[model samples]
Target: MMNVTRGRTPFLLVFLACTGLLAYAYYAQFQLGLEPCPLCILQRLGFMLMGLFALLGAIHGPKAWGRWVYGVPILLGAGWGMTTGARHVWLQNLPADQVPDCGPGMYFMLEYDFPLMDILREAFTGAGECAEVDWSFLGLSMPMWTLIWYVGLAVFILWALVVNSRGSRPLEQ
Candidate 1:
């Protein structure tokens, strides 16, 4: 039993570290004058809530009912992320003028190597439009990757729930 308990510690550590790194990224954007888009904001909220749930579950020590407690947050976060990703995908298909200006200039994407001419182009680009599905890395759009992330999180959380449930079973069973 103690060995099982000790094993959980590493899981908890990774969870905290991942969540903390994401939080720091969000904080950096805000501090560096890079406003987050609507999807980014929503994802951040989900991550924060997930972090809280994990923190609570760690403190509670994974009792039977505590499985339910931790499980809910991860599921909720996944739903939130899914919605954001869908919205982003929709925006990528809309006409230029119809897109929503979720935030300020494209400077938030300075890391993208947008040239002076490109900046001028985006000055006319409007907010997030359906026409511009330009952002991609590893051949996946930001929204597409976010969708994968949310689904992956959901799977992992469910796995944790299952593991915790099995651990609580009686030896006779």
Candidate 2:
């Protein structure tokens, strides 16, 4: 309906913005010389998945049943991003002595070090490198900012999806 179509615009804008952020993250790594640890990589995956779901939902602009279907993936992706971002923040706040020892780089884990499931487990649990606070803005570290962004996006998308799905029904008398 008209409501779903119009609502899709925000989804498109938000998804595109997420893509831009991911682009900046890569730029920070490759151009600015900031190294991404395994947990950072996991967070990146979450963003990518979230963007993918958002793109699909925006394009489909599905009615009722399909709308709910699209919402599930979007919500799941946001939840994933929130979880990873929170984990990263937790690792960053740990005392130096409490930080876990560094694991092999992501390359080794994928190519030789661990099985797929183990690699994911290691990435989420975070090795020593995940605790480094090499980047900050306005006193908040990158992970803190990432967590904030994920929370905001999750809330907005959820609200938008609910409103759109309900359409413009009249109140019961």
Q: Which of the numbered candidates is closest to the native, going by highest lDDT? A: 2
- Kindly give the stretch of ten consecutive residues in candidate 2 with the minimal lDDT sum: 1-10
Estimate, for each residue in 1-173, the C-alpha lDDT of model 1 and write its tens digit: 44333334523642675486476656656675545453555566666666677677677666665666776876787787777666666777677677766434554645577676655444334446423554566987656766776777667767667666677543553
Residue 40 of model 2, lDDT score: 80
Model 1: worst 10 consecutive residues (lDDT sum): 2-11
- The Cα error of candidate 2 at residue 82, in Å, is 0.9
lDDT of 2 by residue, 65-137 (tens): 6766766776787788889888899999998999887877787887785888888777766477899999999
Candidate 2 at residue 81, lDDT?
Answer: 81
> What lDDT does the true structure give each of the candidates?
0.61, 0.79
> Model 1, residue 65: displacement in angstroms?
2.5
User: Which regions of candidate 2 are displaced past 4 Å?
Assistant: 1-5, 169-173
